[model samples]
Target: MTRVVGKRAARRAELFDQLVGLFLDEGFAHLTLDDVAARLRCSKSTLYTLAESKDDLVRAATVHFFRRAADEVEEALARVDSGAGDRVTAYLEAVGDQLAPASARFMEDLARMPGARGVYEQNTAIAAERVRTLIAEGVGAGEFRSVSAEFVADVVASTMVRIQQRDVARATGFDDAQAYRELAALVTRGIAR
Candidate 1:
């Protein structure tokens, strides 16, 4: 019984990993459960048993990506070797690192499916709130000057959104890391006494 349970768990993990890899590599819109099953050399029934639907698989994949990203951001923020400004910088850099590839493919996928826009927007807002909270903490520590944390957060969020926009991504040479660094510097200066 224990061996059977462990085998099932391992199979589910393998399926989930394959689904995420396919979603990231091929773009979610381009793949189907059949494609996934085919790629995994598994039966459609097996895939369906693991995920109720393709939408479920996509949602799971997205959640997995964001959860990993959130963990990285949290870890970056908790680093004692860095000051508030440096921590903030590390946080932004970490975000850019995740967003660079993901956003490009996501934007392309979302362009064709309007329904997914809401999910993307909600996630963006959450990221902004997190950044805003960080700014607020910095201000409380006297690392940042007196300024509206909400407004600063909005600016950072909006800038990131713009960066994700298709034309801006292309115009900026896809160097979101550079853009994020510059934006962080600008924000840092704005709130610095």
Candidate 2:
């Protein structure tokens, strides 16, 4: 029984990964269950085991992508033993790297869907708080100049929201990943002692 359960879990995980990759490459806005099943080479029943409906599946995939990205970002940050500035840069660049794989269409679809967008917004808020903590630590450690962590975090969060909304892309002709890279450089230079 345990063996059967483990195999089922592994299969589900494999399907979930394939689904995410498909969604990342091509937007999920137009893909139907039949399309998904055909692309994944699995039955509709197998997709149902992942999510109840198409929207639910998209949300699940978005959640999975963000969760995996967060884990990777933290792992990347952990590898940095340097000062807080380097840590902040590392965190943001890691975020950029994680997001680089997503297509513009996927991002557009994400913004259009409320459930998926909510997950993204929630993650952005959490990331803002994380940035706030990193800035505070930098200040305390004398690695960064005396700047208001709250203010800096608020700025970063606002920029992230704009990036998510596609305003930055429209205005600067930069993708989300490129915008994040520019943001990291700007913030590190702005806050440096």
Top TM-score prediction, candidate number: 2
For all predicted structures, in order, the TM-scores are: 0.81, 0.98
lDDT of each: 0.72, 0.93
* 10 residues in a row with least lDDT, candidate 2: 11-20
lDDT of 2 by residue, 1-193 (tens): 9999999989988888898899989989999999999999999998888989999999999999999999999999999999999999999889888989989999999999999999999999998899999999999999999999999999999999998988999999898899999999999999999
Error of 1 at 103 (Å): 7.6
CA shift of 148, model 2, Å: 1.0
